[model samples]
Target: MDDQNKNLILATVLSFLVVMVWFWLFPPEEPELTDLPPVAEAADVTTPSVAAETTSTPTTTPAASETVAEAARIAIETPEFKGSLSLQGARIDDLSLTQYREELADGSPIVHLLKPVGEAEAYFATFGWASAEGIAADQVPGPDTIWSVESGDALTPETPVTLVWDNGAGHIFRTEISVDEDFMFDYVQSVENTGTSNITLRPYGLLRRHGTPADLKNFFILHEGLVRMTDGELEETDYKKIVDYDLDPREGTQAVRLEATENGWIGYTDHYWMTTLIPEQGTAFRSTSKYFDSRDLYQAEAVMALQTVAPGETTEVTTRLYAGAKEWDAIRNYENEEGVTGFLDSIDWGWFFFLTKPIFWLLHNLNVIIGNMGWSIIALTFILKALVLPLAYKSYVSMAKMKELQPEMEALKEKSGEDKQALQQGMMKLYKDNKVNPAAGCMPILLQIPIFFSLYKVIFVTIELRHAPWIGWIKDLSAPDPSSIINLFGLLPWSAPEPGSFIALIAIGIMPIVLGVSMWLQQKLNPAPTDPTQKMIFAYMPWVFMFMLGGFASGLVLYWITNNVITFIQQYTIMRSHGSKPDLFGNITSSFKKAPPAKDAPAKPKNK
Candidate 1:
């Protein structure tokens, strides 16, 4: 094989290896729930039971049979959210995001964030007190204890609601729930001890999901389970990992616990939504992520240090809950302004966070200014090319010199016929004299690998890219190219193969076809190799890439197309500047021409 063919094969193998390593390191999406053991109903909180001394238990006032609609509720109305809080446990459960939806189709149901406890897929956030010796389990508000609304008629951004539950033995528990225009909720739990003796209790916040969500993406790149930031460190645990945690004998559940000495938060995160408990800053708390095998329940809790309340004295603890879309700006604001440490990291930036974060940031700002994500991706490609233009220029110049030396190389080969060592020595001397580096062409390919992976990560994981449209039939940039050629770009009545399927891998799309065309055009800068094997490999490389990346996100495919076009323009200009004109049209025509037969070896009889 010639040097050009060797370089081509090396580049192709390296590119393929990089992608394979990426998939190996970060596996693809898998089923959300598999081999799920049958689960029993969660223990009802209404009846008085001996609560564990070390574990915090959330109690409610109604039986499990009661429907959410039958229970008294405090209506929640905000600029971005609309839902209700269940008065049965004063749990902030029934929430729906007014800004988002279940699908991109018109009139799709609003995205439901939380559900009441008695519902089929019970998911909700509840706050309660864990008692010590003096405070009886019944004295503390159990799940079955009914609470009456004391202050507000309804819960809104401007008007908060206060719930009051009296133990009837000189102990009163009051919960004041307030909402912001955004997704943040403030719950101030205060207790008044009217009896003579002092009582000790610990305030705790718990977020529970009875079963795994049905719509989990389950993708390796996007985390959809427990996420917590504690003492400047971020921790994320998947549902499977949490379920497999070591059993906590005291709690009788699989659990992982952390003692957060300072600032910390704990919650559950979905693909585009998250609900986290933000305990008061500067306070120490015990954080726990538990999976109750009996009920198939996933729970994250922040239990504050125990506090004592004297007779006639009232003690109050304030905690915040965040439940809404994982918008970049909103989460960043919470991180920067509200001092939620590493809140932005909760978006699953992955191992390439350094690249993914800034890449998405620039793309987001470009989209805001340009008003199109697809075009923004194109612009980003241009910017990246411009930034690396110097290196690319050197690489192209070296390639141009190599092409210029081809005639001399052919002459040397003929002169040193059958002498492999002499041919190599001559070739090395020729390259040194020309000031060309054989490895220079590999630079551009190496540089693009990380950028491509980072951009793929950004498009796949960020919520800002979710449902973001570029143009016709491309309603979601984050999703795979919807226009498949197999269906003739939707001309056929049948649909394309499902994503991640074998058929989808081979079924090329319009973007992939465009990508193949761009690559072929770029290859036209040089003539096809004379060797049949090399020629075949070069001929099929573009189509191979087309099929390989056909199932990738449309935005990434757009970037690849843009990059190829820019590279072609750059190489053509630079090669011309180096006094080597690239005959693209001539190369295309000559590719079809047959090679002349090999000449007979000169007679060796005369020398013998």
Candidate 2:
């Protein structure tokens, strides 16, 4: 075989091998309920501060379900959020993201980010003082302690609400909670000591979840669990990892802690939304991830440094809570403008952060300019192809140079047919003499691998693509193309096969069909291989990929189609520029020509 065929075959086989192993190599996410580590008598949420006890535990405060009656609630209304606050612990529970819905269906309920204790998958954030230095446990409010509403009737951007708890021992605790038009909430925690003696206390903010989130996608591509940033470093701890945490000798519990001297936040992040505790930046704080193995609960804590309050003196600390959709622009603004360190990285950029970040940046800006994510993706394909044009030009030029040497290579092959080593030597000398690099043609195909994965990560993980639409039949660019050939794309009276089933694999949609066609058309740029094995492989490759990726997100399939088309155009134009115009029509026509019958073997074959 010529070096061109060898290179092309090697690239194709490598791609095929990668696709074949994709299923088992990168395992799908295990079900949340089934994958628990062995458990001990788990502890409740612990105070991340020193010598301070929780009302529920080795420290004190209830993070699990309780028989306690529902506490009085204050309505929280923001343009992007609508929920309630529980006065019991001044907890921001019962919150829903007004901007997002439970499903794409009409009239679906708004996405609930936090729920009260009684609800399934209960999650919320609470802040309180951890009593220390001679301050009794009762000297500070616990989770069960009810607070008096001291100010606004509702929590809104224009009107902040205040909740007051009196230790009645001459120390008063007040929380003034305010919200922005979007998702951030500010809490001003103030302590005033009226007694003659001073007191030591640490104010802590925590996010607690009861059991695993039932809606966990559990996909390995996305991170949906405990995500935290300490100083400038980021860490993600999944539920299973949290469950397996060893007992901490420092906190004397099943937990992990890291100190952030300057900037940090701790939180639980789901597929699209997040609920995190943001301590004041540029301050020392302890970030902890704790799991109650027995209770099947998880908690993230941001405990501030211990402070002493003198008699008649007041100490106030301001912290923030981010509880809503992880919109890229909004989060980026927090990182760049609001000084949330590495905040934008909160989005799961995967291992390809270098590529995913910039790809998302371009896609985001393109969407902003075009107002349609589908078109933006198509436009992104154009820009990407343009960026790689120089490399692609050299690759195609090398391919054309190889095509120019095909006649010489064939003559050498016939002359050295009985001497395989001589044929190989002749091919190498011919390539070197012509200054043609046989391997150059494979570079673009190899480069496409990483770009493909990075784009897939961005499309699958970013909120910007969620429910984004293009033209008809392309609603929800993040989802598979709903049109199915099995039902004649709804022109038939029956519905299409259910997605992810074997039938759906065979019943691919319009986008995947176009993808296969684009690949086939690109392949037709070169004549069909004369070798039977090579011809069979090239013939089947495109349709095989079509079926394989039929179930992928429409946006990804759209990208693949666009990429293939642009590649075909670039190869054709570059080949023409090199004075080696591809005989595209002749190639397509020749592919349809029936193969000639082989000569009959002699009787010796039958004897064997």
Candidate 3:
């Protein structure tokens, strides 16, 4: 079609697109599911590795194979990691290692148990080591570092695994395998060093993680805790694995590499509190030391170098791992455990921390008082609106004065229809004469944008709002509206969109119409300009706003709707005082008592 028509269509389309995108980006809240506890099984079986037949050649001797098989069996059977020794009155037994639901002193949740099946297997990739390279179920063990033990009684039976090193050099690894009650066997391995030069190795430690399939049946994804910096900023960090890593054609293995740094690092993940111990810290890179962010899974691995000692000087590294759900309070006792206690809450912070932290604190405190998150949001909006009301009042007064002088403006516009420059000059002169500020209305609205952004963060990230309720038909405020629009047969049912709750949808749908109409009416009552482009812009403002609101939060719409209703009432009052009707298209002619002369300047006559 024509350029003007095309421009109008384009504007409408652009408005519609923005609305859909905003709706998708910032929809209503939904409830989150709680983390489930680990499941109990019946019989522990010794399952074979995929490469058992091919890799078993080394440990194939009858005696060696038997020993290896037994070791594998013991490791697979126990679901919890048990240490064989004790310190003081407490004994490090299977119970200490069993999957215990304990909390750290800081009140974070944690699970203490043995290595996660998926995580243990993933660790094999560090240093290019593979589970297949170790002893497999059907494979025979050789006379190398690879060895195995079967029965539960034989595997670390009351014996603490220890590390001895001269500068922490050389490498040694041991293993055991067994199945659980459900016939699911897990493989376990321990690595140590007995050398010098601080015994720093390229491939460091392994952190066991569960496969995604296992996670689907249990566990949830949530930030383990928050971190505060010296600058008073706070950050949210996640330490729990969501979905378990997949073993087949694994996207989980993408983080299959590692790097070493001289600074030395300590890494730990918690359900909320339980943290792994570092027997001997070492700074080194392990090829399989990468973290993965898969479709539905997350896992992290960390390693560090311990203190260095000269030749003839010896040091020991001993660590115990507990795998299970977190018991926040119980783990707190570990803070005094001597080795490492304040390990789970570490998080990274950058420059933005200072700016974002107070915002979080404000939101946090607000959450406590309002109990209902939706109401909390309303409260926040009211506070912000109140703060900016002075600027809005200034804008409103300016608009009122502009309406009072519309007669003079319209006379100038009609008199200078053909002379654009003359018309502008006349308009400016009138504005100057009347001491009006044309930009007054634009300034206040501009200041409100940042507040809007802050509100978005409050609604989107606060876990307190997850599954929160707001009046009727909105069982979960955090989730999208539950109304559906699917057509099963020939009939169209009353299905709303996924994020459209009956109340919210009604509010959302109705507010915009009201907003649009109110806006149109406001425009009509205001002074009209002679510039065709200006006229066109004012004409399209209501439609543009409507489409923009289509994707806005019902709460945001509620705010706008309230603001508009108030303004409409205010404008009506202003009009009655002047003894005239409010125009629907920003025409301010009726607000005045007398028509003024055209303000456009007369052009000089041209000689032929």
Q: Estimate each model's TM-score.
A: 0.87, 0.90, 0.48
Which stretches of model 2 miss by more than 4 angstroms?
Answer: 1-44, 52-57, 62-68, 526-532, 585-608
Sorted by TM-score (best first), the order is 2, 1, 3
List model 1 lDDT by residue over 114-179, tens digit each: 977545677888888777757887688744446889999888999999999998888999999998
Residue 599, candidate 2: C-alpha displacement in angstroms: 30
Q: On residues 1-608, what C-alpha lDDT tens digit does candidate 3 reach at each position?
A: 11233355446546656765565456533424343232111011111112332221111212222222222222222344433211100112122334432421245343333332222211111111222432221222112122322223433423322211111124444333332321112233334434343322211233323322222211122234212111122223333322222332322243322233321222233322223322222323211222334222233333333223334443333333433323322233333442223322231212333423454455446667877655665565556556667777766666666666655665666777888777767776776776677666454445655454454443444433444566554445444433322332114566444334334443344446666777776666554544466567768977777646644544555445555555566656656665655555444334354333333434322222
- Local error of candidate 2 at residue 88 (angstroms): 0.7
Q: What is the alpha-carbon lDDT for the whole of candidate 2? A: 0.79
Q: Rank the candidates by lDDT, best first.
A: 2, 1, 3
lDDT of 2 by residue, 1-608 (tens): 35466657657765765865486346566555543332211234555445643322345554434422447888998889888998878888888888888888799988888876656666778888877775776678655567899999999889999999888789999999999988899989999999889898888888888888877887778898989998788998888888999987766668888889899899999899998888989999888888876667788888888889999899999889999999999999988989888888789999999999999999999998999999999999999989888887787787766665554555665666678777777767777667778777666776888899999999999999999988998889898999999989889999998876678878999999999999998877643443447768778889888877888899999999999999998888777766665665552111121212112211111101
Model 1 spans > 4 angstroms off: 1-69, 142-144, 410-421, 490-507, 526-535, 587-608
Cα RMSD of all models vs. native, in order, equals: 5.7, 6.2, 13.2
